[model samples]
Target: MRRLLSAVAMLILLTSACGEDTLAAGTYDGPLAAEGRQGAAHRVVECDDAPTGGNNYPGEYDNGALSDEPEAALRTAFDEAQITGVHDGYVLVREDDDRALFTFTDAGRVRQALIVHDGEAFGKEGWYVESWARCDYAELPAAVAERAGVEIWFDADGPVSTRRVHSADGPEHCGWQHLTFLSLGETTYVRDADTEYAEWTDAPYDSEADLPPHAVDTGFHRDGDHLWRSPDGTRAYVGNREKVAVWPRTKDGFTCA
Candidate 1:
């Protein structure tokens, strides 16, 4: 009995250690924010319909041979460009001599597809952001999609739910403002606008107590300088606010319509 208990304890310890290792291995410590010029807009289209080359999707001036390891080469390009917030969870979906396709979940839990083209046909080399969708994995070449599927994991500290409120009209739309609320675990982070926006602020808090209360009500209240939904999260009262934004909860997450 003693030997059996010891073996069971050892197995449990090994399982715990393996779980921690896997989590740590998948953690990404790179810049969580985008830098430099923004890439092409995300769109749903056939892989063959993806843009080839232009100012928006510039090609590198490389006269040498293409790198044998396309995945590593693409990682180098992504790091050099300081692209969007792709923090770990990378799966190589397809690869060949001239092109490689990868899928990764961004910090916002938005699945994105990336393609690295050798540019042999166009005499240049470059990487492109193929597609990004909120819930589903963006469309890909049928074969690649079959292999990649839609499996993705979010970091413990990554955004699990997102809610947004935007100003519909302003002084020539000049004073237009947007607020995004990202819920990550027990904490909620608020941003003034999307990460790509020029001016923005990021604030994180644990609970309503952390925010300065602007007003209080039985069901609705204003905390953290932003209006919040009721405890049930069904209704919100925005006094004198121009627009009321309500996002329905979906099986995957919050859907903003």
Candidate 2:
């Protein structure tokens, strides 16, 4: 599944060029305003199942609410994530080339001046959006928009700019029956065959022969949905296993870190 996801992501990245007259293969489908996308209301979208939102669109997205306090909240989240090196009186966190999160607070009130964001595509929009606008239902005020420093979003067409909306009822909302798969690229990795790990072993063995002079079978097992085989070819692992890998572009790429 990871390989498949990577393949799809690669295809999307390769096709998502900012050129003209292209059919657009990638779909960072955020809450389409035309379809009444209100995917910015945080703390309200009850993610009971935590499905991937990008499945609906090529790319997934989210937002944060900044009142008079943003810097403090950012510091908290950053510190909690164990990310240091916040010197310029601001904290910028980004994973992979596509995902970014940042916060620039006032002199000290980080929480009150916070502007939260999540799952944003790169190149199209850079970091930091502030707003003084408030939500009536959530008890936010208008000044929030004016105070906001950045806006991140995806659009099919029209005025291209990211804006925050009520995500509790937005298109990016993740739920059951909603398998948002990014049609990235066609996969080439091989799966396991019943007969043997043909991809790893030399085929053409007519008989299930036994050990040949110190040859011992180690067997196969699972390592988190991935299958593994020892270097000596004497033993093998199967079931839930993941091979060491990276995304080349996305953060946690290949999960090496």
Candidate maximizing lDDT = 1
**Could you list the CA RMSD of all candidates, in the order they appear?**
17.1, 22.0
Clashing residue pairs in candidate 1, if any?
none
Give one digit per residue, the lDDT tens place, for model 1 in 57-118. Answer: 34432423343344544455445543333323444544444444444433322144444454
What do the candidate models score in CA lDDT, each in turn? 0.31, 0.23
lDDT of 1 at 88: 39
Error of 2 at 127 (Å): 18
Look at candidate 2 and tell me the lDDT of residue 107.
22
TM-score of each candidate? 0.30, 0.16
